[model samples]
Target: MTADENWWNGSVTYQIYPRSFQDDTGNGYGDLKGIIRRLDHVAGLGVDAIWVSPFFTSPMADMGYDVADHRGVDPSFGTMADFEALVTRAHALGLKVIIDQVLSHSSDTHPFFLESRSSRQNSKADWYVWADAKPEGSPPNNWQSIFGGPAWTWDVRRRQYYYHQFLKEQPDLNFHNPEVQDWALDTLRFWLDKGVDGFRLDAVNHYVHDAGLRDNPPDFRDKTEPDYKTYEMQYPVHSKNQPENLAFMERVRALTDSYPARTLIGEIGESHYPVERLQEYTAPGRLHQAYHTALMHKPYGAAFFCKQIEAMFRDAYAGCPNWAFSSHDVPRHVSRWSDHAVTQDDFAKMTAALLLSLRGSICLYQGEELGLGQSALSYDQLVDPEGKTFWPDNPGRDGCRTPMPWEAQAPNAGFSSAADTWLPVLPPEAARAVDTQGDAESVLTFYKQMIGLRQDQPALRAGDLVFLDMSEPVLGFVRGGEILCLFNLGLTEAVIDTANVGDTLLSRFADVQDEQITLGGNGFLIARRLSE
Candidate 1:
């Protein structure tokens, strides 16, 4: 099992939202010790790596995303020793550890920001994105935060506005300053020296914004999305996905390349031209891989999926993609795509198989393996600021970020020893706890099986994809030139003639008889093509 220069090739990286993974201290909050306690569970899934979300020292403005100190672990999550232990234990289990690095922004409480805001003549005054307000005291530009407000926040001391692409507490860093870039690189070095295998760079596309401070063009697209945020009303051309980000990525890549087999996976959150940015950012000498929010947000269907995948491969031929159907920020895929499947469990298994069959690396969100659907939380139970702002109409991400259910009958579903959790665990999620499905022919087992198949099959792991002509509802593609992967995204049965398609390798809720394949509702199949 030797790895090449690109060890992440054809691998599965399980994403663990540290706050909800496990709470080992009975503090009602997940910590490093909890993740260490659950390493075996993750290893059992046969994933190649684990991507732990930020556990950095922070003010918790946006959970752990708003870091107050880049190099220190948050006291709530654990100390530096605990993080070291986690890395050591993960390495012992043959799992590479990829920690989330939120380089785009930091909490306003961060030391640099504090100093920068104190006075205009301070040494670090320009460390963060600061601009003067227009004559009318309006924001410098028409940029909007992803969290539904103006991107600029007024600061009394400096009498200037600081930009934040999220909550005002999270001030965006000024990549235009060479000193800031150097400092950011040094921060990456600190983690790399700590024996981390890689980093999932948060909001990599947002690293650089238009230096000229131009207004973003309006987004006139029809608003059909149920949970549409006001931020989506603008094109965000000048706010993010700037060309300067590519050079900065190259700098990031140069640093990671110095470490043996270390990788960098950038998260590109651009609503429009995300794939284009992903392709540019992940090209050779840039980040090793790039993941966009397309899969997590798009409507479920063969056509939509096929179009996304094909566009990614076509545009980013030289780059690698890290595909994921769910994450801490988005609703769980099983629930998000519920209308497209027959049953939750059935859809989970089918999507698992389909995700594993795709080319490039994959990221399995923490609870997806247990077929966990979104936990419906009330407005009062919501902790995500985005959810709170759009409550009733748009429930926030707390539903997806709820604690991981470990025990079906235990207190707080065994997520915490405390009577209450940060977010309530709904009964539906508790019922599908890991203990109940550990041995059964459940979604967890199916994920393990599919992942094992991916690990054993070279074609499925590192294959070049070639789409086959198939009608609506059925997606057919050849991987590595020999493996035929087909999926039925419709609710009804779909049949495809397999007169020339080869040996059946794996099937989920589907059957093949007399050279014809019949995929039941939400079914899928993977086969090896017959050699000429």
Candidate 2:
């Protein structure tokens, strides 16, 4: 098959949260040059590509997720030349680069938004979603922001309320306007022309809201749940996730297809019928792949994995999934699932195996290979707006967004020369730094072996996934009818007969007898089928 056809079908991508990944200037923030210096380490991991979070020109209100200029590199990240060199270095190391594209909204300071809000009849007027308030000066609708409170912010310049799905500083663009659609496409072309392999489209569902200015109905599901987010109190069918996204995605796909081997992946933040939305967005002519937060949530069990995996493959029309255990926006899986493990390293190794063995593509967050857990930060040290807004009860994602620890005893864990980081580099994280985990039994070593095994065994990559019948705490599956994978995900030992399975190809904490296979807690086995 040609490389362009489906290079990401079962590929593995390493995600780099640029600000906390590596700092080269001793400025307490990571930049493009720091990432360039670390390219060799990423290439050594046997990953297919790297997906970087935003580094575009931004005010950092949302830490680069809010873009002020779509086409320019932020000075905090480095000059435009630094980005060009980064792409050059990544390609030389055999690593494809995928950058974050925040297309749904732009910073309020953006010139386009400034012009759009400037009197109703300016040349750039109608560039953003603008609506007049009610007679009593109330918001146009009951739609809420994901960050907090009302989704509408009043702007006196045009005597209208502008829409922001996230922070008020970020104004949603009017995709219903063809001109805005063209501008978004042009922003994407700006990067494709710079040699990027793909883009991780941010907030793909929030692109076009209902043009009718409808009020969202109350959501009955989450009102009873503890610590339920205020925004999710109402069903957002009309507020966002409009059917219009499907056609807009096709336009994005068409532009991406113009370049060789380019890809487009979308992030669906929908809570209602999420998997279906993921599939709808990634249909043949749209996004190449799309991911939802199903796996990233707190649910952990064989049944949960079985059901979620089955949902993705059951519908042939829904495009394939790219699975992740942790990311910049969520808590680290090790810390999140600590109840299931006897040791953090064992759980980390087991989760890594499970994620890699899945049917679709994989994305590994930085420091995952080293078994890094989420860092706990004091309220005073919080950097995430989400975390600060929701203190105590929900400490936000700052815990998971800590700096990458590269060395154990070196200054700031060899991540930066500065004494402090934008987010503190906690000691627990520094203890498991890459330098300290090179032992034969380290999680890092196991990750390399697992990634190599997946690359070596085609059945693990593109093979069809047929789940075997197993009860709770024990999961088994066959790939391409040749490779059988078994896992014991409990806190105690389990023994099962595996006489039908052939020689073991890989295992951890597993012992095989004549017919019975003994699996210790968090144990796993990958064997070739005897009949194959």
Global lDDT of model 2: 0.89
Error of 2 at 19 (Å): 0.2
Off by over 4 Å in 1: 220-228
Q: Local error of candidate 2 at 50, Å?
A: 0.4
Q: What tens digits encode model 2's per-residue C-alpha lDDT throughout 1-89?
A: 11555788788999999999999999999999999999988898899999989999999999998898999999989999999999999
Name the lDDT of candidate 1. 0.89
| Tens-place lDDT digits, model 1, residues 317-416 | 8678999999999999999989887998889988998899888889999999999999988787878898888787678789999999999999989999
Q: Model 2: runs farther than 4 Å from truth?
A: 1-4, 222-227
Worst 10 residues of 1 by lDDT: 220-229
Quantify all predictions' global Cα lDDT against the true fold: 0.89, 0.89
Clashes of 2: 0
lDDT of residue 290 for candidate 2:
80
